[model samples]
Every structure is written in C-alpha cells, then in structure tokens.
Target chain A: MGTGYSIRRVERQDYEGVLQALSALTTVGSVSRTQFEETVDHWNHVKVSSEPEILQYHPYVVLHGEEVAATGMLFIERKLIHGCGLVGHIEDIAVSLHHQGKQLGRALIDHLTNLGLRHCYKVILDCDERNVRFYEKCGYSRAGVEMQRR
Target chain B: MGTGYSIRRVERQDYEGVLQALSALTTVGSVSRTQFEETVDHWNHVKVSSEPEILQYHPYVVLHGEEVAATGMLFIERKLIHGCGLVGHIEDIAVSLHHQGKQLGRALIDHLTNLGLRHCYKVILDCDERNVRFYEKCGYSRAGVEMQRR
Candidate 1:
C-alpha cells in the first residue's frame, strides 16, 4: 500500500503501457495494435458486445510515474447455491520483472482483495506451484486443488 | 441426441421453470416476480451492465414437452499465452431429481462441449470428488487441482 505507484482502472492509452508490463510474464507474445485496442475496448465501461451476466470483469494496472508496473484482472461471480451471494475470481496477475521484489506484487494483490471484499463475499485466485508460498505470505491459505485442460 | 427432448437457449417464460429446476440443486428461496423478470432480462441478450469481451455467456435448458428437464451455463474464454486462442468453462449445471439416472447430465455436458469446440480450443469444468468419475466418463481427464477461497 505504500508503493509510490498508483493503481487504477486501465484506459485506452494504457494499452501499450500494460503490454510493456505484461512482457515480463512468460508465454505471452506480441499483441497486434488492433487486438490491443479491442482488449481495451472490452475492458472499458462502454458496451461493445453483449457478454454474460455472471462475469463482471475489471482490469487494473499500477503506474509508476508514466510506466505500468503491474496488472491484474478480476471477475465478480454470482453464486446460486452458496450462502455467499457474490465472490471474486482473479486471473492474469503480473508484475514487471524489474519490479518483482519491491512489494509491488503484494501491493497489487492486497488492492484487489480489498476491492473484492467491497462487493464479493471473498476473492479467490489460482497460481502455479512456484507462487504458492508468495500467496501464503500474503495471508492466503491453500484450499482445494486446481485442475485445467488445454 | 434423441431423448425426445430439445436443448434451447433460455427465454423469459423459462424463468420460473428454470428456477423450479434450480431449486433441486440447492435451497433457493422463492423469487419475486420482478426479480425473476430481471434475471430473464439479464440472461436474454447480454449487457445489463457493460462486461469484458473474453466471456460469451450462454445458459441453456433441456425441454421435455412443456417441462424443463436440465440446465447449464457455458462461457467462452480467450487465452493470450496458449496457442489455443479460446477455451470454455461450464458452470451451474443441474438436472431435476426425478430425471436422475437418465443420461441427461451427460447429454447436457456433451452439448455444451460441442458448443465450446465451435469457438474454443477446448472445454473445461470443475467437479466435486464424487462427480469426477462422471466427468471422466464424459471424456474429461483429471489434469490439475482446483483451489479456491470463500
């Protein structure tokens, strides 16, 4: 929370800035300008397409002066069965390689968790094996198993 | 495919019918007429509030004559890193208790999987330990673990 960087919702101008931050993450490749614009449009509050109601998607970034330092996406889900009516799912969290150790990732996660608590019963995220301890240090305890395909 | 039942997208009138079916899955209290109408409105076309583009949400139900037999919701997600551009996530699947032991569950999963394949690289769903074998029978294999909080 004490980071010099400011965290805010992503904007059209932040597309390239976010991409620069995303480059530090593994497996992501070059995104065309058009594709990037489309992504920005989707994340923007403006309605371009009719998306399902269950996913209330929000993407945010941390800016240090003019440079993007970290980014994450969050989705609010409505649960039918659980007594908890709303919950959050987080995906695609990344910090610029240069910003790794400065508590930037921790700051970003904390910010998201706070936001989720405002509307969601609780927030959840999935990480690879390497990041388990990192999340545990952030006050998250391991629960269940993660399964995926493709 | 020939169960004398037709799978179709949910419509406004299907609200009560679907809610009746959903009641079997959990303890959902009765919904006011206005709430039911609002839910149908949300599911019918897409945007209630603006949402991101990655997920194309669709909720479907199986109709046997005038009765609703089963239901499921599917989401198509676009992946950035994987060569696979899109994937599907299935949730909120339910079958009427009276309809159990029939292949309705399998039929619904297969139907959604086919829909996912049309636009996604693969389809995925998470199940409780008890239902793991059921999904395995539907051609999904255990690939990883699922973790969550709240």
Candidate 2:
C-alpha cells in the first residue's frame, strides 16, 4: 500500500529480478535467461489450457519503484475430497534485505493469500520454526508436521 | 506384498474406493460417480498434454483381490529454482482399517515415493504428529512446520 510499490504476477522480463529476490530465501543457482523464458512460456500455456484448474502455478513479485523487492508463489492443487476443491500451496516467499521493514513481505503475502482464497478452499504453507510466528501473524496456524525426502 | 495385492494408478472405477480410503484422513462428503469420472478424464487429459511437466497429478491405489486397500497421491510441481526442477508433494496416504498392519501402507508409500523420485528432485509431505514415525520409517524426516488457513 506504499507509494511506488506494487505487487503483480511475475513476467518473463522479471526473471533476473525475481531470482534475485528469491535468493534471499534459498540458494538459486545460475539460470539461463532462455531457460527462464521457456519456463514462463510453459506457465502461460498451462494457464490457457482448457484442463481443470489443478496444478495451476502463480508466481508473484512486489516491486518497489523499478526494483523487485519481494516474491512468492502459490500453487493450486485439485483434490478429490471437499467436492474436488482446490487447495493452495504457498511457497518460496522472500523479501530483499534492502527492502525489509517496508511491510512489503506482509503485503505480498496478503495479496497471494487473497488470490488463493478466491480460488481455493484453503491456503497452506510450510515454514521454518523461526518463521512460524511470522506466518501465524499472516493468518495461518500450525496444522501438521512437514516431512521430506531428498 | 501380500498375495492378491497390487499397487497401480487409480482408475475411474476406483472412485468410491478411493474416497473411502481418503475418509480415514478427513471428512469426504458425498461425490457423485459422474463427477469422479469427469475429474479422472481431466487428469488423464493433462497427463497427456505437451506442456512442461509442471502440474502432473498421479493418484495411486493398492488393491487386494479387487478391493482398494490403500491410496496416495503424488503431485509434481515445477519450480523456477533448482534449474526449474520438479518437486513432488505426496498427499492423502490412507489405508483401510481392515487392511492395517499388513505393510500395505508402507508398500503404497514406497511405490508413490519411488514414482516421485524418478521425476522430482525431492518428495515432500505433511502428516499428523502421530503419523510422523510411520512416515519416518518409510524414509521421510521432519523438515519444517506445516501451517494452514481454511
């Protein structure tokens, strides 16, 4: 809600900027511009498909002036339960260190969660224990244990 | 594997059985047989699309003498990071009470996990604290906190 700050779906041109923002969250190794564009094109194609809205991916970025300051992704998954309802999986939220404290992260999360709630029965996410309080403040609560195998 | 027991992709005819298995996880309201068939067709259509393997959904079930004994789902999500790699989300793993203690759950999990690893960089899931040990025994470890808003 700040002046000169806006949140929108990520574009192909925002590849580098989006990756830069995501780097604040985890290691994002070198990605060629072509690869990024291809991935963007893939997302676009799926968005236009007539298939059911299962597996829809929406990656968003917050821009402060002309710089990408925050990024997050929401993946909508269709489930057989709940009358074949959609479930949103929010992931990879990151805010650039330089843009921290501007409430950009909170705004971006609100934007994504709102988008999710519009189309999903529930929005869910996984975060480190240290960030539980942050997400809890974002209107989420501890629901279950996260398990992984790499 | 027990005699007459086998795991494979869920078919349209397995709708009632699949929902019955999922009921052990949560409340699954009544879903019409036609709705289930339509959803199965949509999934099959997406699986055969030329689009990048971003939103592939695979639901599998273990059958014992033609009765669905266990069920699970693996959703592969395409990520911009990790070289645009795929991340597998395993969900709704359930076994009928009559079929419990026969290692059917473990076998179904292994089958789904193996399918995930073949196409994804990592496989992730969420389970209740009571089920942590079970998933751990199936080769998963606690990774993060699961948060949700319904």
Candidate 3:
C-alpha cells in the first residue's frame, strides 16, 4: 500500500498505459488505439451481458498516480464436469520494471484471483519457472504442466 | 481408423454421451438433461454468432456407432497481445475406458488442435504427468508450469 497506488478495472483511457505495463511480460507489438478500444468494448459488453458466464473477461490494472503499473486478466471457462462448474484462467499478469519490489504484481494477482474465485470452482495460471516461487507465495501451488503447440 | 468410429461436432442429443465420456476424466456429478441442453444451446449460439471470436466454443465427440466414445472442447480466447491475436485452450479431453488405445483420443486432439490453429496463434493445454507424454506425441511441448488455487 504505497501512497498514490490504486487498483481498478481497466478502462478505455488506460489503453497505452495497460500496454506499457504488459510489455513487462511479453511482446505486445504495435496495437492501434482503435483496435484496443474495439476489443475493450467487446470485452466489456461480454462482461455485462446475459450470455454464458464462460465468455466473461475480467481485466484489471494497478495505477500508481494515474499511471498503469501492473495488469492482469481473468477468463472464466464453462465446463460440463463438476456439475457444470466454472474454471478461471488467469493470464497476462505483469508489473512494469520500475514498479518491481513494490508488490504491485502481487496486488494485481490477488485482485484477479479473488475476482475469479468469486465465480469459479478453481483458478489456474501458467508461468515461467523463475516466477513459480512468486506465484506460490501468492497462495498458488503447482497443479500440472502447461503444454502448447505453437 | 476403426470401423464404426467417427468424430464430429457434438449435438444436443449427445449430452448424456458426452457426460459419460467425461466421467472417465473426472467426476462429472449429476447434471440434469435440461441443464445440459440449455448450456449446449448457449454454446452453439455463441459458436455461430459474430459476437467476438473469444466467445466461440468448439466441442466435439467421437462416436462408436451409436455410442459416444470420446469428447474434447476448444475455447478461443481473444487477446491484446500479438496484435490482438487469438489463443486456444484445449480442455476436457477424455476417452471412455473401453475406447482407449483406439486412437480416438488422439484423433479428437488432432482435430481440435488443427481447428484451433486455423484461427489461433497457439493452442495450449494443461495435463497431468501421466498424460504429458501423450500430448507431447501430439506435437505439444512443455511450455510452462500450471499453478492453481482451488
């Protein structure tokens, strides 16, 4: 809890700030402002719609005095198993280099994890080995191995 | 490649069969027929709608004559990374005990992976240690570690 630090749902105006925060995680490339607005609009619409909960997208950003310092997203997946339960996938979590050691990453992760746990039976994520200890400290444990075909 | 074996999109009528197949993977519990239909209907509607591709769900079942032998689902996730690219999550892949070794599981995985790759930059999944080799044989390499709070 540093002064001037706050966390909230990402808004359209945070487009560039969010991307700057995400660059700490992976290559975000050049995303036009129009494309960002359109995607955020669609995601917001899904978040509030009567559609199946599986389509829900919850994205959050941490602001250090109006600057996006960290970001994370939670996706709810519908499943037939466990009596039609919901599973949450946490993705794209990042904290800007300058913001490291401030616990902003943990804050964003906890915020997203709590939001996901509200409606999900289980919340899961995949991360690099170096980050495993950090996530474990965040109350997550090793569950399985991530496999990919890219 | 066996006679009387076929894989196709799951129909509303395949609800019970799909649940039966899923039980081989984990506890499915008791899901009313009506609940199954309603969820399937919603998923199908999203699958066909122009409402963001992230809402799209592709579920498939392998039929052995009139019986369902296997099932799998692919969820397309919209992302701001990679220039607003798509990522596919393959989930709930299972095969009936009697259907094991028939390559139905492999067939379903391949079908879903190819379907996902057509629109996704990458297809990803999480699996237990026992199933890791099988997925690796299906062209998926270990990408990262799966962490969860359940």
Query: TM-scores for chain A, candidates in order?
Result: 0.84, 0.92, 0.92
lDDT of 3 by residue, A1-150 (tens): 588999888789989898888888898987999888877876776631254333478888889898888888998877889988888899998888889899888888888898888878899999988899999999999999999998
> What is the full ranking by lDDT, best candidate first?
3, 2, 1
lDDT of 2 by residue, A1-150 (tens): 689998887889998798898888887877889878876766655541245343377888898887999998887777788887778999989999888888887897788899889878899999899989988899999999999999
Could you give the candidate ranking by TM-score, starting with the highest?
3, 2, 1
DockQ of 1: 0.33
2 versus 3: better DockQ goes to: 3
Model 3 segments more than 4 A misplaced:
A47-55, B47-55
Clashes of each: 6, 0, 0
Q: How much is B69 displaced in model 2, in angstroms?
A: 0.9
Q: Select the stronger candidate by lDDT from 1 and 3.
A: 3
- TM-score of structure candidate 1: 0.81
Q: Which numbered prediction scores highest in TM-score against the true structure?
A: 3
Better of 1 and 3 by TM-score: 3
